[model samples]
Target: MIRTRTQAFRLTLGTLSFFGATAFAQDSHLPEIQVRGPRDATIGTADSASEGAAERESFQSRPKLRPGDIVEAVPGVVATQHSGDGKANQYFLRGFNLDHGTDFAVSVDGMPVNMPTHGHGQGYADLNFLIPELVSGVRYRKGPYFAEGGDFSLAGSASLDYFSALPAPFVDITYGSNNFRRALAAGSRTVGDQTWLGAIEIEGNDGPWDVPENLKKANAVLRYSQGSPNRGFSITGMAYKSRWTSTDQVPERLIASGQLPRFGSLNPTDGGNTQRLSLSGKWFDKGPEGETTISAYAIDYQFDLFSDFTYFLNNPVNGDQFEQTDRRRVFGAQAARTMPTKFGALDGVLSFGAQWRGDRIGEVGLYNTENRERLSTVRNDKVQQDLYSVYGQQLVYFSDRLRGYAGLRGDMLRYDVQGREPVYGALNSGRGHDAIVSPKAGLAFTLTPQHELYLNAGTGFHSNDVRGATISTDPASGLPADRVPALVKGRGAEVGWRFQPNEDLTATVALWQLKLDSELVYVGDAGSTEPGRASSRRGVEATLRWKLDRAWRLELDGALSRARFRGLAPEGEGNYVDNAVERVFAAGVTYIDGPWTASLRLRYLGPRALDTQNTVRSRSTMLLNFGGRYAVNKHLTLGLDVFNIAGKKGNDIEYYYASCTGGEVVSGACNGGVNDRHVHPMEPRSARLSARWTF
Candidate 1:
């Protein structure tokens, strides 16, 4: 294993090169256009739904997907729903803290779109702005296993892929749920054997929060590609524009009042607009040196926001209150080549990437003069990193019943970061670089053509700096905020079995572990700094499938996780009192018969932070969905989805940052119990319905 330390100015320079005047038209694809994840894409596997439970899974079913009503179908996943009243609209993942890096990573085709202030946990994309009809596929992956584009990597990665699969051009329009409505159009064509694909989506909805979060959005994509079966190249561009009425978060006190916001009113926290743009490309060539492929990408995110409760009334007598806006961007590149060798096949991948971000931060006041202020704080930070890796896997045919292989990759990377902002204390950027020589190895033993056993081990890392992308200060305290630590270093191990008892049945089970240097807490006072302590995630996952002779199929999946922080310190904010959960269980079942399909899912959340004491609580949720696809003549299939048949409410624990002061104040209006002490509430229930026609 050879670990590398050289920085990649190469990725940056290459990203710019991709935008030149060069354009290649895509050739018509015959059957299917495959869209996949970083790791799985190169491995030649795209059957994620058919993969036994032991492997990583995406949040959504496929790539190039757009979905609104679909979020409710997955186990252990939920969006803060409206009770048909168009109220609070927000979503949480894994009960971890909800913002930016602490939550799930959302991207489009492997390019990140999350706003710049990542460390403080501010999510860049709001799901409500997406139009369901424009989607091709949405995928969410758990754990830190696969190959990803860049930073905020602790929570895994979720990706969105749009498509050009139909005949000519088409338009779609729909209205349903929460007074929700959407309009979208997408298609592709051929010019001189060159394929050209393009799509545009727009959507808006009134959220169900008390002070409802209203949202609107527009997104567009254009692509060009050309090649015969042996060689091909593609170029693409995407842009997104979104606006929302802020739903100011409630103080723990008001939440205790059992009061929700009123409809058609200003949400008190944040509202306004956010936008993003991205460009990417890929080249594939069949060569004498096996198969060669190259890819590159870049993205930028910006947000303009306002607070719900104005501190300044734009009056001449007083300045504006605490309103703020930020602009952030991240860019990088990757290149790899795969060739067949005598020892199976050898794959060499070199990933070179960098990130640059600037926060044009200023405070504007509203209702109160004491709070009104427009302080422009400029922050510029950049990171240059490069990775060198070599992995090989060989399929061994041990007799006729046994097969599988040994796989491994050696990796090395370095990160350098520095910049200055008006907020004094956060690091003025540091050489945040460390070289880790990590190794990966795996093997599978075949018992019979119908049965097999597999074992695998790999290592991964979170950033080293405790402070992440966004450097936030408590508006009241004027001190830095809390969130997931800068880097979480760890490795994982897994052992599992796959069996095919009969032509109609397949089953799989595995045990795995993930150990970390610093634990992640998402509770009353989230992000405790526990230096050198290693937290661990241990569990078992399993899946079962039955393909009855023909026309009938059934699939079931389940997972149980035990996650915890060890040797945590209370004084220094150790892992012990953090808000994240200690254990969890998830299960899903799907059945397809004829042109109709039905599914049911259940998630069991074990003990988790209920208060600052880290008091643990328990909750379980169930969901049922039914869908039918009738071929109204061969070319068109009618589809429908139903969710939350049980209507159960589940809570994902939440928290904030606090200076224990033995209990003393760090800065301004932030003080004492309620405001500083974190308080989290359960989201309500809501429903959505949709239909699609494909030609």
Candidate 2:
């Protein structure tokens, strides 16, 4: 370890002396030597083999239909959408259906993206505002074995880093099927000691639904920075707004009987609008003393959504349409430091960090509605929630081939709620608090120059909705309701191995298990949280990357898992966890030669249980996407991307539930309503063409 200034100086002097002597003996001219460090290495420098980083160039040619697909670059992860494009994407990993990012954490440029206690859902992480072109790389970890991971990181976490400066300014424009259009402009310039970066994006699309989904969106980003990553400061501002019409899932019975089209909407008026504005800044420095980083952010957000999943089931006359709204401001800050350590001839590092966040919600409400008009208010409330966390971790090299890590973390959460409505607010107004402590440990052994093994275990937690943690009575039924704890705990363990036979091939495999004390289940129709049973999951994952030749590269990833409820249920209920993903596989090939770049990707999602009984299940899906780019000249490039290349028919999502489709009454569908599989069909094959110009 470079523990002191004197040691660092001595090492520097030794290297300079050797190079000077070599130059003097060889010739009059000196030979240049470039220094590189292991800033993003997991095979030998990490505690777990499952943690790694993806460079921007690795996925630059990937064909993406939605911005959230950026997360798919992480091995064994899937991102899909069931509603409009503007909404957050549904995520699945480690046998868990991470509803809107509930168990998986996401961040961009040191700012959290997962919103706690959102109107639509808890941990609602909308990535539509992301501009893929501006991202430089992604760092990811799994199994909750890291002290840096906080809320919603039980299964995994991903962090996206942006480029400080671009090689050149560029403008990109694209047009595709179904009236899709997009334009983007981005660049960076240095002014004296500081650099300024700016980007803007505008997009619109009409999908292939019976009712056109007129989606419109806009996004902008501005940033200022100085210095380098080891020593730097930056401030950034972002703005995003979007509106879209949604086509929710339709009943299989209705579609089979010709009563509804596959992509038809029961309520054409269903839609939503949302906006977000934020400012964030960070500073960091690394020297002989240590490494330190500090960051802070403030955000203002607004959302409004209208949906009707069970049409005519609750109110036959009004069609069961309803609205959910959320308006709030969020503030947060975090700081961390790492220092070199020596314990009796052993080299090591000690790290610690602190985090604080608060959310002030002006109003969060649900309403009964018809079309787009609100008929009556259901419940409205104001809430303030605050969270604080601190953690310490240490890594020590026990021998030349063995290393060990240990960490401890503590977190506290507090919330206050006030009912804004007269009748409903009076029944549910209250306050609550909760706290938890977690510990983590890991061991790594280097078996050979090309092989390494790891073992890790840790505990993590996610916060429940403020309303759920403080409710005294049910807003809809006026019945006594039990309040849930502010935070729920999770435990995880993994054994992994990494192999690097040469510079051209790398492989990794892991076996992992996770258990949750309680799951957070959000009821969209009622805008409420319902308690879910404790669950356990175990899975196997593997990834491989091979450079076949200079121009050809191949990548493959696969995962299989089993998930089950922990305790016995009702007589008819089974132990299976609903919507738990069972198997996933992905493969891709890239060809880069001269001025031509092309890529092809294949993804497959296996069947999954849709009900606890293990009876109702969702169908499998397979898709292929292709992309190719040709450089017209040094200043211009043309690209073509084809999604769903084989035109395979599939469903983005599926659910088994009871819903009334109006015709159910005449058709005597199950007496009360129709109990069937509801599905949101995947988008059809589409082609997009783009032109990029550099100046």
TM-score of each: 0.70, 0.93
- On residues 1-695, what C-alpha lDDT tens digit does candidate 1 reach at each position? 11111111222122212211011112223214422211221011111111211111223321111243344233333444221211113333343433324334555443444433333224334443343433444444444333332333344445544443345466555555455666667777766647787788877776555555567778888877776545777777878887766444333333444443322222344455667676787665654444444556666655454442322222223322234444545455444444433323322222222222223222111112222234443333443333333333332333232233343333444444444443543444444333443444445454454566766665656543322423355433466655334444667667777676554676767677777676433322221122334666666666565655455555555655555566645573434434444444445544455555444444454555543345433344344434434445443444443444455444333343332221112233324332332232333344444444544
Query: For model 2, where is the 10-residue window of minimal lDDT?
Result: 22-31
Candidate 1: lDDT over CA atoms?
Answer: 0.42
Shift in Å, residue 135, candidate 2: 0.8
Clashes in predicted model 2: 0
**Candidate closest to the true structure, highest TM-score:** 2
Candidate 2 structure quality by residue, lDDT tens digits, 389-415:
888888777776777889988999988
For model 2, the stretches where C-alpha displacement exceeds 4 angstroms are 1-40, 522-529, 666-670
Cα deviation at 455, candidate 1, in Å, is 1.4
